[model samples]
Every structure is written in structure tokens, then in C-alpha cells.
Target chain A: MYAKRIITTMFLVTALVITLPKGVFANGHDLESLKNTVEQLKTQLDKVQIQLKAQEEKTAKKKDIRDLKQKIEQSSIRPVEFEINDSIVHLAGYSSVTFADNDGAGDRFNQVQFSPIFHYQYKDLMMLESELEFDIGLDGSTTVALEYLTLDLFLSDYLTVIAGKFLSPVGQFRQNLHPGWINKLPSAPPGFGHDGATPISDVGLQLRGALPPLGNVRTNYSFYVANGPELEAITEDGEVELEGIIAEGFTRDADGTRVYGGRIGVLPIPELEIGISGVVGKTEVTVLDGAAFGDEPSRRYRVWGADFAWKYKGMGLRGEYVRSTIGEVTASVAPAGAHWRSWYLQGAYQFLPTKWEGVVRYTDFDSPHASEDQKQWAAGVNYLFSSNVIAKFAYEFNEGRVGKSSNDDTALLQMSFGF
Target chain B: MKNYIHIKTALHAGVLILAFFLATAGAQAEKHPNEEGDSAQGAKLWAQTCSRCHNMRNPKEFRDELWVAIVTHMRVRAGLTGQDTRNILAFLQQSNSVARKSSFTKSSTTSESKGIAGIGVSSQDVLARGKTVFEETCVACHGDDGKGVVPGVPDFIDGNGVLSQSNEVLFNHIVNGFESPGSTLAMPPKGGNEDLSNKDIKDVIEYLNATFGS
Candidate 1:
């Protein structure tokens, strides 16, 4: 039994030795494979972490883009809407300051005038225009005056109906050339001022427009009926004599008379214009020595004028003549006739490439009173900063009745601006 | 006398009624169509009419809307025809905007030293187009004889006048604006016609050379 046990054990031992050798070899190989697998897992984990980081960076970039787009949308300017039918208001005007030295009156800053023109328009149908004048009086006080006001209605392509106080159609000087910036000289012509031969203004309705072109000759006409002028009488040397004619636009027709007047301008060429004007009415003496008067007889009143303007390149030439006559009055305190007449010729030449202009004018004024009759020559130099802004220097030589203010020579320096 | 008073009153009433009727009729009539203005004709009329009364105002002095009102006011004051008003307004409106950049391309035959050459276009066609443009645009200030009509307009017929310059210089002057040495006004770009193309300017230059060049 001992011998059999030993053989069995030896056989079992042999089997165990072969199987343990094979198993040991398999275990070592498996451990080497396990280590390789762990290394592969580590490499895979690193790759996953890199991919996740890439995705996170992409998301962050998208967020920045969104924020930038939001910022852009927040800041911008939009357009304003405008319609055609809306009412439009425009302001325009002229202003002037003058320094004057007269033979009798000393030199001073004698005039400061601001004329503001306001326009309110409702399409092309109608427009309301007004000019307000502000002046510094000689007494250092401010005076406001309405230069003119008109409601102009466009009746047709070539016609307009105007209602209100308007610049008189009697002459071109009062209507067109009176603006300080437009007048080449620093002062108005000798008798084209207040209470001059030319009527200043009228309150009435006017029809003014251009006529159809007649060949190459164009024409414009203005017709009006207005409250006429009033007369003044003075007590001098125990006799009543007509003093002056107040032709400024009167709000009331004290004489209950109407004046009919019209002006026709013909332009044979673009550069030349010839105009003729006339007025006929009746006027009564409403004031006696600056006081109100009653029961004065109405007298026949008439005014006539002629004017011409020619422009060539930088040179301009213009002339005007006016006459006013009052018929004799038999039933009034002032029974005598009176008349005023005046004429002026002016020429201007501008030196181009330079803002300089030279002007000369000759004027003759004849009035009822000998002391008021005058003849004058005016010469001026102008510097234009722009087309609308001008500086003028003028000298006037006057000849009249001796020792009268009308005979005083004067020098004027003026700066005028139109906007 | 009483009969005279009655007649006068009737006349006044008649005048008032006539004015009212005219106003109402004008107001009720059809509004003017939004017609395009003729900038070319407008330029000519503006040069001729504005100087008749006052010095020429700069187009840049006011905005577009303000020009409308201002021109309307001038229409009444100057007794301008409706066509005249429209034309002037168009010129002013076109002149007030920012100038456009020139689209002129250098021609193959054109050299820096030489003046300019007709690029693929016949000289005859170029000159014809140029003449039309000049008459329509420049004739107001520059007369048909090429002598200046206005005070400071440069004479193209003079020996040493504007046409004596190189074509390149003339092109630049027209594309941009130019003011004469002694002029009170400056020529607006493209002669105030913003619609003028680079080719139109080129043709005009050629026309000027053939017709008025020294």
C-alpha cells in the first residue's frame, strides 16, 4: 500500500508540475496585457479631456459673438419723416448801422436799424409776409415800426393777389432799391426819403405779376387802389400854407378818398429794364399846424415817375425821376397849389477778383419851399464780404439855399447785412 | 353825390369779391404735380434772374426746405414765372448736397504728361454731347460765343483762358469745382448737375478742346 501511494502521488505531482508551469506562463502574459490596457485607458482619458476643452472654447467664442451683436444693435440713428403739405416758416431780414457826419450835425453813430422779415407759407397757395423795423432813435430810444405786411395769394402761375400794407408801386426806389444791402451807396437819393416826391407806402390790394414773354421782351405790372395821402397846413406869417404831404400807409382813410395807381416794367433784355408809374387821387387837409382839422376841401392829387436800370457784367447804371403835384383848392384854408419833383442818376462798377466797388450819383430835388430845393453829388466805395454783407463809405456834396440844412454836405459809413 | 358814393361802394365790393373768388379758385384747383425740376435750365435762369435785383446768393446759404420757402417768397417779389421758380429751386437743391467722387477712369491712350484722350468714343459724338451739355448748363454765364456773360466768368475764347489748361486739369476742375482768380462766385461741381457721369464730363472736356482750346 505504501508503494502504490507513492506512485499515485508521483503521478499527481507530475500532472501538477505541467499544469502549474502552463498556468504561470498564462498569468504573466495576462498581467503584461493588463498593464497595456491601463496605459491605453489613460491615453483615451487624455484625448477625451482635450476634446471637452475644445468644445468649451467654441461655446465661449459663440457667447462673445452674441454679446458683440447685441451691442451693435443697441446704437444707431434713425431717419426723420417729413411730409410735403406741412406749413413752413422762414425768417429773413436786413440790418444796418451807420456813422454819419453832416456839415451842420456832428458825426455820430446816427442809425441802428434792424428789419426782420417773417414769412409763413401754406404750400404754394398763399403766404403771409411781414417786415418789422427796429430803429434806435436820435433820443437813444428804441422805435418799432411795421415796414410792410402783405398776404399774397398765388392766383395763377404768373399772377399774385396781395392784400395789406405794401411798398408803393409809384417808383422802383421805394420798392426795390431801398434795402441797405442792395443799395450801392450808403444813403438814399436826395428826394427818395420820408415825405419825398415818391410815395413811400400804401395800404391796399394789389395785383402784380409777370406777363407772358412778348418775344424777347419780358414785362411785369403792378396795379393797386389804396387809401390816398393826406395834406397838412401851417400858419406862417398870418397865412395858411400847405406844409407837407403824408403819403405813408395810413390805417384810416380820413379823406374818404381812394388812389388808383399802377406801374409797368418792360425788360427788353435780361440786363435792361424800363419802368413807368402813375397815381391819381384826391386829398384833403386833415392837419393844421400839427393839430387835427375839420371840413377841409379835397384837392386833386397826382404823382408820376419814370425809371430805368441797366446791368452789364459788374457794371450797373440806373436813373429815376418823380413828380408830385397838388391842384389848387378854393374852399380850403390853404388855397395855393404845391409841387415836388426830383431826379437821380447813379452808376456802379465792381472790380472783380476783389471785393471792391465804386459808385457815383447825381441828384436834383425841387420842392415848393426854396430852402428845401437841392442839387447833390454822391460818391461811394463799397467792400463786399459776401454778396449779402456790405460795407459802404460815401461822401455827399450838396448845393441849396445858403445856411439851410438841405445844403449840408455829409459823409456816411455804413455796414449792412442781409440774411 | 349820393349816387357817386353808392357807385364807389359797389366798386370796392366788386374788387373784394373778385379777389376772394380768385383766391378760392386757386386754392381749390389741383395741386401741382410732383414734377422733376430741370436742373440744367434752372442753372441758367438762376444766373440770369437773381443778379437782376441783388447780388447772387450762394446755394449753400440755406437748406433744402428753407430754399423752398425762400424761393416761393422770391417768386412773388421778383414776379418769376412758375417754371422759373421750379427751375431755380432745382438748381439750388442739387447744388447744396455733398459732392460725389469722380468715377473717371484713365484711358489707355491718355498719359500723365499729355492732356486726355477719347476713350473708345468717337470724337464727333463726344463733341456733340459736350456742346449740348455746355449750352444747357454753362450758357447762362458763358455765352454761345464762349465769352463770359457774367462779371467773373472765365472766357473760353481767350488765348490764355480756361481752355488753355491741360485736359487733365480741366477734368479735375469740372469734377471738382473751380473759382476764377478774380471771381465773386465759384463754379459748382459738375456745373451743379449731380447726375453728370464721368463719361459726360470726359466728353465735355473733349468738346471744349476741339471747339475752344488754344
Candidate 2:
């Protein structure tokens, strides 16, 4: 009976062990699987963080690039430009090259000229202006000349006081229209040139200004007191007579006389200007046939001029008349009174929207010497490369005394630039 | 002897006249104060005065500082008033800004190619405003007859003239400034009026077409 009971206990224990082991092993396997999943999830989170940081860095770089582009765009619209200060120095002027063929003289590249204008300004009150002309002469020599120099004081809105050598205020040609780039043709009017009827320059004190508008009319004036001009006389064939008037700025007044002159201009319309000019002085003959003279009595000198300019659309019309007279002096080598008279009428027209322009001028010059008198008609056409640059071709028909150089017809081609 | 007497009398007269002018100059200055320059008035003066002696210089030819010197020199040469000088300077400075390349787009290109007007405004008020602006600003160089008064300025009445271009081109030119072919001078942006609005430009373009177009 004992042997049978022991065997039953053993069987019961074995059955219990088998059933509990299966259930417990299953739960342990599930916990191990959950631990593996947590490890994989942590690795994935690390990778995602790295990728997010990279994306954030790239976005920042893109924003930086956008800002740089915006800055470039803003800078392009209005650039930082130059600033002007007080006490400015400026240089401006003109240059010209010409080819000419006269009736008696052969054609050649005869002219090469450069004129430099210097300006030094102190605010709006004062300015020092000077012009220097350099020219290549026929003798292959270079000539340098001071064209004009003046210290301009702006006294008021309407007036300026100018001191030093200044262009003559007698007429418009010498003062306003003599620049190569400004003049439509290559040559000056017959009597408007040097040793001609008009005065070239003067060393003096000048008061110049424009007046306030009177209704529809505007006016301008220039008055000056200067060292008077000197007279030149020549002795030929037992005759002594006045040769020419040296109206340039003289450093010394040998005659101890002063000249007074002025010009008054009236503008009836904005496009039209009329002017009158006059001068009064005493002049003495200082040179006789290119020789010095002494003890010459002073002679009366007078000059009067009238000028008009009208512009309508692209057409311009202008005219000027001048007469210079010297009274007789019994004590002088050339005692006979002499007079130089001159007149010119000019017209210019521009073809709009084109670079071509046409100009015509007629001039009559009469002097005491028959050989010096001239009547001329000048016609020209200009092709403007710019407003300040021009190429001109002109022809002159001249009539003077027989067998005189003044009677020679001429043709000219020129290139001029104003800078 | 009589000539010497005449010279003395003329000298005295000149001195008296100079004194009178000196006395009156201060009064004139006081009467005309140093006011801000008017670009419109300057345009008129430039057209009237510069062409009287020389050809009109393009405003773009010189920088601001250079223009100041040149104009000052011209003031002495031409005997211009101080006010006139300031006004011309104002006009030159306003016009001296450099031109910019246009920012054109494909959409705008397509519309322009199709000849479709963009941002159309047909109001009479806008047209009248355009007319007034043109008269006040452009009449100095371009006459009331739509023909240019100055050399190298385009004639608006010509069928194949500047108006023949597309509206986009015209708009770009008017906004940024333009230099015509073979022309030395360039038309300044907004006709040198910086105060002009984009709408004003468009209206003027329309007016140009309606009035001066072939």
C-alpha cells in the first residue's frame, strides 16, 4: 500500500510543473519583445532630431541669401553720387581743327586751337574766371595767349562787379559768339575780327547785370571804364594816314586817357533781343608803320553799334552794325580823321530731329583804306554730332578792291568741340 | 581839348549811373528773395536763353559739380540773374540722375505683345491732369503743336515716331529716362519732375496717344 501512494504524489507534481511553465514562458517572451521595440524607437528619434537640425540650418542660410538679394536691389535704384563743396575749381573750354582754301592761298590743315577756361568760385558771391588760348601758327610755332581773365563779384541778384581784362561789351560777337563751338561758321565776319572795326578786349572795371522784367519786356546792361585804345599810322607813297585801331587790352595807357563804354539790351519777347552800344574816349597814335612814336596829340575816338537777334522755333536771325571814328589831330603824323564802318546780317536754321543745320550771313565793311574794305556772303551747313560738337563746311563770296587779298573767296571745313 | 572835356563828362555820368545802379541793386535783391528754384521756369529759361547763343547742352553731359561751374560761367557770360542761375541748376541736377534698366516680366511682355493696354484709366480727370502736366513740363522743348522746338527732340505727330513703340517701352522710357537714337540729349525721367506718380505717367502716356498719335 505504501508503494502505491508515493507513485501517485510523483504523478501529481509532474502535471503541475508542466502546466505553469507554459504560461510563465509566454509572458516573459512578450516583455522581451517590448524592450526591443523601445530600443528601435529611440534610434529613430535620434535620427529625426539630426535631420530637423540640418533643415533648420538650411532655412537660415536661405533667409540670409534672401536678405543679401534685397540689399543688392535697394542699392541699385538710387546710387550714392558726388557731392559738391564750397570753393570749387572747374575747367571748361573748346578746341578746333580747320582746313581752309583761299582764292590765292592753297588749302591745308591750317588751324589747331585749344582754349581752356578756368573757373574758381567761392560760393555764390565771387568767381575767378580765366581763359587761355593756344594756337598752332602757320610758321609751325605755338602761340599762347590769355584771352580774358576776370574776378567777378556777385554784388546782388541783378548786378555783378567784374575786375580785370574782359571781353569788350561793345557788341555780341566778341563777347558771346566767338567760341569755335558756338559760332556756326569757321570764320568771323569781315570787320568783326582783330584789327577791324570792333574792339576785342579791355582791361577795366565793369558793372554788369540784368534788370527785373518790365511788364513783358526784359532789359540788361553792361558799363565799363578802361584804358583807352591806341591808334596806328602808316606812311606810304608820301602819305601818312591811320592804319588801324588797336582795340585790344593794353597794359599801359600811354595817352593818359580813359575810355567809357556801355551796352543796353531790351527784350520785347523772350525770343527777341535788341541792343545798343557806345564808347567815348581820346586816343593818340603810338605806332607809325610798326615804329614807336612820341609827342603825339590825343585825338577824339568814338564807337557806336546796334544789334538785334530773333529766334523762332529752330530758326534764328541776327544783325549787327558798328561804326568807329577817330577825329583829326594836326600835331600827329597821320592827321586825317578816319572811320571804320561795318554791318552784318545772319540767319541760321536747324532741321528738327536731324543733325543738319544751315546758316547764311551777309557783311559789309568800309574803312579809310580801300584795300581793307570788304563785302561778303557766307553760307554753311553743319552736321552736329552733339550739342557741343560740330562739323562745319562753309564758303565765302567776298568783294573788295581789285588786286587785294580781302577780295579773295574762300572755303573752310572745321571740326569744333566744347568741353 | 574838347574830346578831353567830353571824356570827363562821360566819366562823371558813368560814375553817377554806376552809383545809382549800386544803390538800386540791394533793393532789387530784397524784392526778389532767394526762394527755392522752380524747375518749370528753369526749363523755359534754358530753352529761351541757351539756344540764343549756342546749341542746347544735354543735362547728362556733365555731373552736378561740373554743371554748377558751367552754369556759373554762363551766368557771367550771358548776364543771367542769380535766380535764373539757381533755377537752371535745379533743373540740371534734377535731370542728371542715371537711367536704370527696366524690370520687365514675361507676363508684361505677353500683354504688350498682344497690344493690350495695362492699368487702363479712361477718366476725363486723369486726361486733363495729363494735359496740364505736359504743358507745364514739356512745352519748353516740345511745342504745343506736338512738334519739337529744339533740335534732336522727336516729333510726336509723326506716325512712325516715338509713339510707334509699345506702351511698355514708352512706360519704361518715361519712368527711367531715355536717349533717342542719334540724339545727344536724353529725356529725363518723369520729364524731370520727381513729384510725378506712376499713375501720372500712365495718364500722360494715354494723353500722348490720344492727342499726338497718328
Looking at model 1, residue B13 earns an lDDT score of: 82
**How do the residues A72-92 of candidate 2 rate in per-residue lDDT, one tens digit apiece?**
988755454335256778999
lDDT score for candidate 1 against the true structure: 0.81
**How many residue pairs in model 2 have overlapping backbones?**
0
TM-score list, all predictions: 0.84, 0.84
Candidate 1: residue A266 Cα off by (Å): 1.3
Over A1-419, each residue of candidate 1 has an lDDT whose tens digit, in order, gives 45654565556556645565455446778767656755675566557666877888777577799998877866532223333545788999999999999999989999999999999987777789999999998899999989899998877766788999998887788988888999889889978988888899989989877776777788888888899889888998999988888988888887787888889998899888899999988888999999999898889999999998887778888999999999998888999989999999999988875889999999999998888999999999999888889999999999999999989999999999999
lDDT of 1 at A148: 91
After aligning candidate 1 to the native by TM-score, how far in Å is the CA of A10 from where it should be? 60
Model 1's DockQ score: 0.43
lDDT of each residue in B97-129, candidate 2, tens digit only: 764333332356753544335435557876787
**Range of the 10 consecutive residues with the lowest summed lDDT in candidate 1 chain A:** A76-85
